[model samples]
Structures are given as structure tokens and as C-alpha cells.
Target chain A: MEKQQTDKRAAIMQAAMELIAEQGFHGTPTSQIAQRAGIGVGTIYRYFKDKDALIEVIHENVHGTFISTFTESYDPQLPVRENYLRIFSTLTRLFIANPYEIKFIEQFYNSPYGIAKKRADEIECDKPLFAFFGQGIQQQVVKDLPFEILLGLSLGPVLFLVRDHQNGFVNLNDQLIADIVSASWDAVKR
Target chain B: MEKQQTDKRAAIMQAAMELIAEQGFHGTPTSQIAQRAGIGVGTIYRYFKDKDALIEVIHENVHGTFISTFTESYDPQLPVRENYLRIFSTLTRLFIANPYEIKFIEQFYNSPYGIAKKRADEIECDKPLFAFFGQGIQQQVVKDLPFEILLGLSLGPVLFLVRDHQNGFVNLNDQLIADIVSASWDAVKR
Candidate 1:
């Protein structure tokens, strides 16, 4: 019974993520999510208090996995460029492997829901990554730009590339990821 | 009477852009747009067939202006880096000057409406910019990568930076734009 409950919850999340990613949040509703999940509306309510709660849960799940991949084997003692390349490769791979999740994340982060969540959570979600960039500036290994600009320079291209890869406009092979990461390093390195 | 008609049209466009930028397409209703514009919903129909038509007209107007800025003073014979810097400075300034238009553009581009419009229009919208990048590849001045990847590397950071600027997280001065554009050149230059 517990396993069945868990499976149903997973089904709800999968359906919600896919629908919301393809259609904007306002375009999707809980009834549609339940329909897509092959579950009853009551079942969805049992899993989540409301549509906003469900979306928040989805964001938490997706963002947690993403941040962990970024922080995997992270060592501040490592060269900033090296650390950046490592984070880049893993996060890129994660994004490639999970298009729906990344798409949902991209949309969410750009939407009001994501903005509110970000403010409430503050920068606590990626403290290590933020500190690593700060350390790079302190050590004079990275350009002395504001943290936000540095973030944009280092991560923006990969995010853009992932979108292209998802749209079938580009294939992100290992060699290409390596080259792109190197270019990202160039964008920030002093 | 004609001038009043023009003002009403402009008001509808402005209100629609702001509402759509802040609220996703589906979240906004024609009635709300009319209310925001201080006009009747029927007035909107006099100007547009429906909500979708209104959005499309807005997109056409905004995109046309944006592309013209990109192509202004553009010289194919100039160095790729020089042309890129010129284009970047102008576009960035335009975006900074008009946050609502850029936000609307960004959101629309990532939405289903944007995707469908892109496919129907193909790449016809930015032929000059596209050809310029192609010329760079042919001349061996730019990295030998897919056009999409090249676009991502060159323009993605600026887009990301603009969001930060909009969020009040970054102040993009002229010097910073120059530095960032230089870094963008580094990302794509061979």
C-alpha cells in the first residue's frame, strides 16, 4: 500500500512537470494534471494541498537534485576554473538527461513562483557555488565583476546550449561540452 | 479622431505587454487587459481579433524594432568582432531602456506561442545577424561550432545579465557592457 501511494505521487509529479514545462503555469490546471497522470482529482489533492503547493514541491525536488549535482565532489581548494568545469560538465549532463525537469526549472525560475521562492530561500540554495565564485574573485583568478554578472557569464551559455540541445538544434557531445566549458572559463578568468 | 485611435492602440499594446510580461499568457484575460488599458474589452476586438491576435501584433511590433536596432549601421565587410560589439552595445542599450518589451520577448520566446511562431517564420527574422555569424565561421574568425551554439555563447550571457539587471541585482554601466561584450567575443572567437 505504501509503495502504491509512492508510485501515485510520482505519477502526479511526472505529469505535472511535463505539462507545466510544455505549457506555462497559468495554462495548466490541477484537473488537467490529474487527467494526464491517469489519476483522480481527489488523489492529487491527497498528495498536495493545492496547485501552488504541488508546484512548489516539484521545484524543491528538481532544484535539490540540480544543486547536488553542481556541488558533487566540489573542492574550494581546487582551481576555480577546474571547479567550474567540473560543475559545468555534471550539470550539463544532468540537464541533458532530464529535459522535462530542466525545462520546468527554466520556466519556473523565470516565473513569479520561482522568483518568490528564490527571495524566501534567499541564496541559501547554492551557498557553496556562490562562495566558490567569490573565492575566485578574491584570489584574482576570476574577473572582478559583480557576482550576478559572473554567474551569467559562467552558466548562461550552458543553459542556452542545453535549450538548443533539447530543441534538437544542437547535439551536446562530450567534446562539445568540454569546449563550451573552456569557453565559459575564458569568459570569467582574469 | 485618428490621433485618439492611435493613442488607444498604443495604450492597449502597453497594457497588454506589461500584463503578459508579469503574468503568463493564459493567466491574463482580455477583460483584464481592457481594464488595465482603461478601455472596453470591445475596443480590443476593434483593434485585434482576439487575445492571441493581440499578442501576435505586439510581438511583431516589438521584434521588428529590436531587429532594426541589431541591423542598424551593420556592415558585413567589418571585422566580426567590431560588428558584434556594435550590435551588442545597441541591443543592450535598447533592452535596458525598455525592460517590459524585452521581458515580453524573453517570455514569449520560451513559450509555446513563441515556438510555433518561430517554426512558422523559420529563421527569416534575423537573416543579417545569422549571415554575419556564418561569414565569421567561413573566415575562420569564429569557432567552428554549430550556429545555435555560437548564438548561445555570444548572446546568452547578455540575456542572462539583462534579467539580473531587471531584478535589481546588477547595474550594467557602459564600461561593464563593453567588458562583457569583449568576453562574449572571447567565447566565440577562434
Candidate 2:
């Protein structure tokens, strides 16, 4: 019974994400999420007390999934450059596979919904990404600088590539991705 | 008479930017802009045919100011690292002086305004920024890679810094800015 309930919750969350991505958070109706999930509207209410509750769950799930995927693949034993490469490739694949998640995240961060959750998440998961860079600095593999600055240096190119891809301003390919990864590694690796 | 007209236009643009920064584009009204500029609504009409016309002028002015300021200070004859430092410092100063322009530009790019002007601007001014990087590669002062990739590597940290500053997530200090620029140069210089 517990497993069945969890499945239902996941289904509802997945449906909500798709709807939000298609129509934006403001445009998506709770009824659409319920219908898409093949569940009744009342079932949604059982899982989420209200529309805002559902949206918050969706936001948390998306961020949690991103954090888990990124950290699960992270191997502290690996060389710093290799570790960074793993992160770059993993993120590109994740963003490409879940373009809706990418769009939803970008939209959320630029909206009020994100503001409420950002501080908590930053305290929990986001700081660790910077901490990983600090580890690299300690190991003398990355430049010795403020970890945030190091992060901006390492991740800035990827953001531009992702933004360009999202806007349809440029077409990304394996070779292009490889070139970007190489250039980024060249820039940050001591 | 022409100089007076240009000054009024400038004042109007500055007022519109401040209002948009505070209230968002959708939330702001033309009357508010006129009132802010201390000009009659009719004067705004004389300078701009409509609200959209005014935004376009603002966009053009901001882009023109950024490009001219950067280019005027850029010495193509300098080595790549020095050139990067100069351009980065100039851009940082510009962004610091006109923080509202950064927010306005982000909002503008995410809206229809970006699509309308991006193509034209791509051909005219955007190409030149990339060409400047291409020149660096030719001189062997920059790493050999796709120019866009190199450009991203070079400019990404500065963008993130501006973002953090705008969001009140970080304070902008000369030391932090210098460290970021230096770290970025280390990343890309051959």
C-alpha cells in the first residue's frame, strides 16, 4: 500500500512537471495534472493540500533529482580534471534528457516560487558543489581562489552553451560539446 | 536644439530603465515613465512612437554604449591576457555603474524583444566580439578552440558575478572582481 501511494505521488509530480513546462507554472491547471496522471482530482488533493503545495513538491523533486544525479556520480578519488569532466558530461546529458526540467528550473529561479526555496537549498545541496571545487584547490589541481570564483570560471561556459541551446540560437553536437569541455578544462586545470 | 532633444531622449530612456527595473516591463506604464522623466506624455510620443518604440531605443542605446565603451578601450594590438583584463575591467565598471541595465537586458532577452533585434545585432555588432577573440587565437595568445567556446570561457565568470550582484547574493568588490578576472585568464590563456 505504501509503495502504491508513492507511485501515485510520483505520477502526479511527473504530470505536473510536463504541464508546467508546456504552459508555464501560471498557465497550468491542477485539473490538467490530475487528468494527465490518470488519477482523479481528489487524489491530487490527497497528495498535495493545494496547488501551491503541488508546485513546491515539484520544485523540490526536480532539485533533489538534480542533486542526487550530480553527487551520485561524483567520485572524490578521481583526478580533479576527470571529476570535472564527469560533472560536465553528466549535466549536459541530464539537461538534454530533461529539457523540461531545465526550462522549469530556469523559469523557477527567475520567479517567486524559487525565492522561497533557494536559501534552504543553497544551504543544503548547492554549497557542496562549491565545496567540491574547494577540495580541488586544496589538492592543488585547481587554481587557488575563492571557490565561488572558481565555480563561475568552470561552469560559466556551460551555462552559455545551455542557454544558447534552449533559445535555439545554436545547434550543439558532440564535437561542439567536446570542444567546450576541452576549452573549459584548459581554462580551469592547473 | 538638436542637443537639447538628445538630452531629453537620454533622460527618458534612463527613467524607463529605472521603472522597468523596479516594476518589471509588464507592470510599468508609459505615464509613469513620463512622470519620472518630468516630461509631458506628448514629449515621450515625440521621441518614441509608442511604448515598444521606446524600449527599442533603450535597447539600442544600452547595446551601443556597451559595445562602444568596450571597443574604444580595447587595443587589438595588446597581448591576449592584457586585452582580456582590460575588456573585463571595463565591462565590470559598466555593469556596476548601470546595474539596472543588466536586469533590463535579461528580461528583454527572455521576451519577444530579443528575437526581434538579435538577428540584426548578430550581423552588425555581435560578430565583432567573436572576431576579436578569433584575432586572439590567431595571435596564439588564446587557446585554439571554436571562438564562441573561447568567448564563453572568457566571459562566463563576469556574467555570473553580475548575476550574483544583482540578486544580492554577493557583494561586488575590487578584490573579488580581480581574482575572478585573473582566474578566468588563467583558464583560457595558452
Q: What is the C-alpha lDDT profile of model 2 across B2-74, one tens digit per residue?
A: 9999989888999998887655566578889999998988899898888988888788778888778877867
Model 2 shows how many backbone clashes?
1
Docking class of 2: acceptable
B75-165: candidate 1 lDDT, tens digit per residue: 8878888998988777778899989998898778878769867644437645776798899999899888877777888778988888878
TM-score of each: 0.94, 0.80
Off by over 4 Å in 1: A120-122, B119-122
lDDT per residue, candidate 1, A1-190, as tens digits?
A: 9999999999999999999999868778788999999999899989899988998999999988877776775887788888888888887888899999988987887786687676544376457767988889999998888787788887889888898788776799999998888888888888
State each model's CA lDDT, in order: 0.84, 0.75
Which candidate gets the maximum TM-score versus the true structure? 1
The DockQ values of the predictions, listed in order, are 0.67, 0.39
> After superposition, which runs of candidate 2 have C-alpha atoms over 4 Å from their true positions?
A1-55, B1-12, B29-50
Each model's total of backbone clashes: 0, 1
TM-score of chain A of each: 0.91, 0.83
